[model samples]
Structure formats: structure tokens, C-alpha cells
Target: MVLDTVMTTLHVLVGALWVGSVVFVAGAILPAAVEGALDAAPLEKIADRLVYLSRGSSVVMFLTGGHLAGTRYTIETLTGTGRGHLVLAMLALWLALAALVEVGRSRLVDGLQEKRVRTPAAEVTTVFRVAAVVGILLLVDAGLLASGLALY
Candidate 1:
């Protein structure tokens, strides 16, 4: 019973982290983007901060998920069911997040700091729109995983 409760709690915490990040990016960050407040300097700083936090959170979630699945329930059982789909979704999101971090750092931060490029409206719009889509995908993935539907 205790083990079940602990797994449930950890699962909930991971879901919160994933969903909360998406909510923050969409509700708060997207508005800033639409308003053009997501320009060079501010956007660079915010991206840097978010990237770091996301990296750590992703690691924690992956580790915890692996442990819970391996220790509590057999990995084979999860794979036999459709839970593997959720895991694959998570992996895809993690890849997207990693790519976003790399691009944000290389282009936005480096370019702005080095004056290689100026902050343009079109570029900002593109970046934010893509990020918004990714955020929405992440939210959906988290919701599906947390719903226990994947296990059915």
C-alpha cells in the first residue's frame, strides 16, 4: 500500500511539473511573445532560465518514471500494454525541449550578445509560435499519461 501511494505521489508530481511548465509558457510567456515583449534581451534571459529548469526537470521525471515502472511494475508489462506510447511521447518532448534549448542558446543568446543579428519581429513570432505548439503538445502528453488511459 505504501509503495503504491509513493508511486502515485511521484507520478502526480511529475505530471504537475510537466503541465505547470506548459501552462506558464502558454498563459504567461505567450502573451509576452504576442506583445513583442519577447524581444532580444528579455527573451534571451528568459530562455536561458527556462532551459536550465527544464533540463533538470526532464532528468528527474525520466529517472523517476523509469524507477517506478521498473520497480513497481515490470517494464515488460508496461511495454506489452500501450504505456510505451506515453513513454515515446515523453521522449519526443524531451528531444524537442533539448533542441529548443540549443537553438535558443546558439541563435538568440549568442547572436544578440555578439550583435550578429538584431531582434526582428518576424523571428520572434516564429520562435514563440513554434514554442506554443510544443507547449500544447507537452500538455496533451502529460494529460494522457496522468489519466491512466495508456495503461488500459
Candidate 2:
């Protein structure tokens, strides 16, 4: 019971951090940088920092989520239950989020590091917009899963 509670808490907290960072980057930071409200140097720095933070959160989510699934659920429960389906959906979403972040980091951060020139606003915007949409979906899915309504 204690392990259950601890793993659940860790999963939720890390998930929130991951989603929140994506939203902030995509919605606020990227837009501000694009519109010239924020400086490019600082924006790049923020993105660099978030790359590590986001990766760390993803690792935590995977660990805690795996533990919860392994301990609390059986193959029958995972395949037969509504919550099981939700868990599967959430896993898919998590994979998508991971891919999107990796692509964004490679394109946005790598470009910045390799070339001293500022990354094009349009490129940043495009990458971040996709990531933001996925991030929002993750949050909504999490909400539904938590409420036990994800499969309904």
C-alpha cells in the first residue's frame, strides 16, 4: 500500500512537470521569442535547461509508471479493465511526447549550439506548436485517467 501510494505520487508529479514544461515552452516562451518580446539568447538558454529537466521527468515517469503497472496490474486486468485501456492510451501518449521532445531538442537546441546564429522563429514555432498540442493531449488524458473516465 505504501509503495502504491509513493509510486502513484511520483508518477503524477513527474507527469505534471513534464507536461507543464512543454506547455510553458510552447505556449509562452516560444511565442514570446517569436514575437520579439523575449530575447533569443535567454530563450535558447531556457530551452537548453528544459531539455535536461524534461528528460529527467520522462525517466521518472517511466520508472514509476512501470512499477505501478507491474505491481498493481495483471495481464488480465490490463487487457480487460477500463483503467487498463486508459493506461495503454497514456503509454502511447507518453511515447509520442518523448519523440516530439527529442525532435524539438535536436532541431532547436542542436541548431543553436552548432550554429551561433539564432534559430529561426518559424522553425521554433512549428516544432513547439506540435509539442504543445501533444502536451495538452497528455494533460487531458491524465485528467481523464485520474477521474476514471478515460475509457468512457
The C-alpha TM-scores of every prediction are 0.66, 0.85
TM-score of candidate 1 against the unseen true structure: 0.66
Task: List clashing residue pairs in candidate 1.
Answer: none
Runs in model 2 with CA error above 4 Å? 114-119, 150-152
| Superposed Cα deviation of residue 6, candidate 2 (Å) | 1.4
Counting clashing residue pairs in each candidate, in order, gives 0, 0
Candidate 1's C-alpha runs over 4 A off are 1-41, 72-75, 115-128
Candidate 2 local lDDT, residue 97: 81
Q: What lDDT tens digits, residue by residue, belong to model 1 across residues 20-101? A: 6545654676466546666666756665776676677667767766666566456565566576667667667666765664
